[model samples]
Target: MGVFKLPWSLLKDINKVMRNFWWGQVEEERKIHWVSWKTMGKLKTAGGMGFRESHSFNLAMLAKQGWKLLHHPQALASLVLKAKYFPHSEFFQAKLGSKPSFIWRSIMDARELVKRGTRWRVGNGEAIKIWEDKWVPKLPYAKIMSPVRVLSPEAFVSILIDPGTKQWKTSMVEDLFLPEEATLIKQIPISFNNSPDKLIWSGCMAPVLKETSKMFLPKPTIKNLIKELEDSGGKELVEEFAVVARRDAAVDRIQCKIGIGLIIRDWNGRVVATSRKFRPLFPDPLLAEAMGAIEASCFGLQLGIKRIILEGDSKIVISAINNREENWSAMGMLIEDVKIKLNSYEEWSASHVRREGNQAAHKLARDALLHSISSVDMGIISHCIHDCN
Candidate 1:
């Protein structure tokens, strides 16, 4: 196949002068090695101008056969594979991949047909013939591919892949591997006239034609995935991912329930650090703690007070981050923001204290609601709900 890429002008000519001209063209003009047989254009019996690259053509054809046998197998390769490895099974496995998925096993069966190598017979102690006379009815494949034979449509579909090996791989070998190559072979496009002289068509004498198999694309759309989620055990994770996906847009404190272990500090007035029923929401807790840190730092910046400790029992709330996800997704972002705010202060850190240790914030929260609704300025926390008709 790579040989086809060689320039047409470089093709060896019949006459000595013509061959020299071709070689000179490459050496002086194109500047290439242009090596060749000293003698050119042999008779029909000898098979030469008439110059067939017997070895390269053989290899490329074999490679094509190997490619085809790997994917689709109805040829001698299939028979060989069946006789040796997968006598009763639909697929064979290589030593490295003995345990593979069922889907992979099915694909393996296709590859097996292309690389149907032989094996020794177990009982009788003789190598069983993968290709036998019974398999070929008077070289049915050879007749179609044979230049000597009369033209037959049946011949067009089959070819003797390895005439020397007597390994007649099934037709349509190029179709299997070329399409895979096409997917990877990206380049500038060139116009083609679909001439028989084209190397693509030269495979007519061989078994395989360019493949036309429609690749089976996966059809399970997102809707199908949703259906799968409904039944799959990992549905919770999928649901959680969905929740996290909401963070890009939604702007609300997502609902969360939390464990509470409240404590209060000095009865006099350690009221700045406070906690309440809606307290455990992380980022909120973290933010509150961060606010405490900022304020504690401010004391040094403003009044130059040295001793300071900002503490919070509400680990979740003090995190001061909001995320659609129930986890600490918002914590990192919030922490960074809080850290920047705290930098204004001289020194302070938000400490996570046990409920027993965090009495100051806890007590402030308890005392905050201790006032009677009717007595003190009751409108402080109250707002009217307007009903618009």
Candidate 2:
């Protein structure tokens, strides 16, 4: 599978058989399935059993070949592929020639996924074009947004940095970019310290390879499955009662104290529930933030809320939860525990909000400390709701 792409029909048939075996059904015997194969293939953290889907797995395997062709130019397979299909052009720029080989076609088919995962890491920046290549971390597969006529096609990323000082040429950047684009450009780190421009997978530290199975799994396709269920008389499964909730934490370092607060609200901004709790100590703000999320999620569960959009002021914690990255800090274990707790919900999302947007929760957290209270309910936090308005 790594060397050649599997036929889609063959893969589909195999998955069908696997699904039957999974549910203990024989060729002659028909049986009811508790869950669809599509749902079962979702990530465990997303309420799925983490089963591998055949078509996606095959595409992922083929993508490894594409990755090698892009990043490992010296490999024998890459050399041969280039010699046969793209001798006059780079892998990305190569055109599909007349009657391409099956293997070459398979490899080319996987390029989209590879392109989505990888981005240019600028070093001396000679190899990266400012208007053509993707170097911005925030915007993947996107060039700087500006009129093409304003910038020369040949302009390299190096032109935006001061060669002598190894710093951004701020004046040049400001002149070339709109105010917002200038700010985004400054956020992209340029260094004379590392190797020349290279491609890197966005999620991981290294370039993607065949062994990185996680990269190939299709993003949760639960939406499609939900639609299918709805069409098949499972309409209740597609319905969600969503509510928005904001959470915040306050830590008094000198007193070794921690306070967590959350407010759940309807779309009209009317508060449905509010809670605050005091903890003995939290080593850092991140842990306190994670605890606040856990508390909010648990509180929602107790209220029989099935769908929640959990908001927090901690960008670091919210990003970790949304990305599903393994946290390695002192709060790593606690964050993992919070992630596990979140899996119980039928639908949930963790997002970051600016401090000003989470004022109600922030004030409630501080109130927990002022009142020396271990816990406070919705009735006690009425003033917090008024403050939000």
Among all candidates shown, the one with the greatest lDDT: 2
Best-fitting candidate, scored by TM-score: 2
What are the lDDT figures for the candidates, one per model? 0.31, 0.71
**Per-residue accuracy of model 1 over 205-281 as CA lDDT, tens digit each:** 11221245222211224345556766885745453321100000001124221222122222122221212222222
Q: How many clashing pairs per prediction, in order?
A: 32, 0
- Tell me the deviation in Å of residue 203 in model 2: 2.0
Candidate 2, pairs of clashing residues: none
Local lDDT at 3 for model 1: 17
**Model 2 lDDT, residue 107, Cα:** 80
State how far residue 326 of model 2 sits from its true place (Å). Answer: 22
**lDDT of predicted model 1:** 0.31
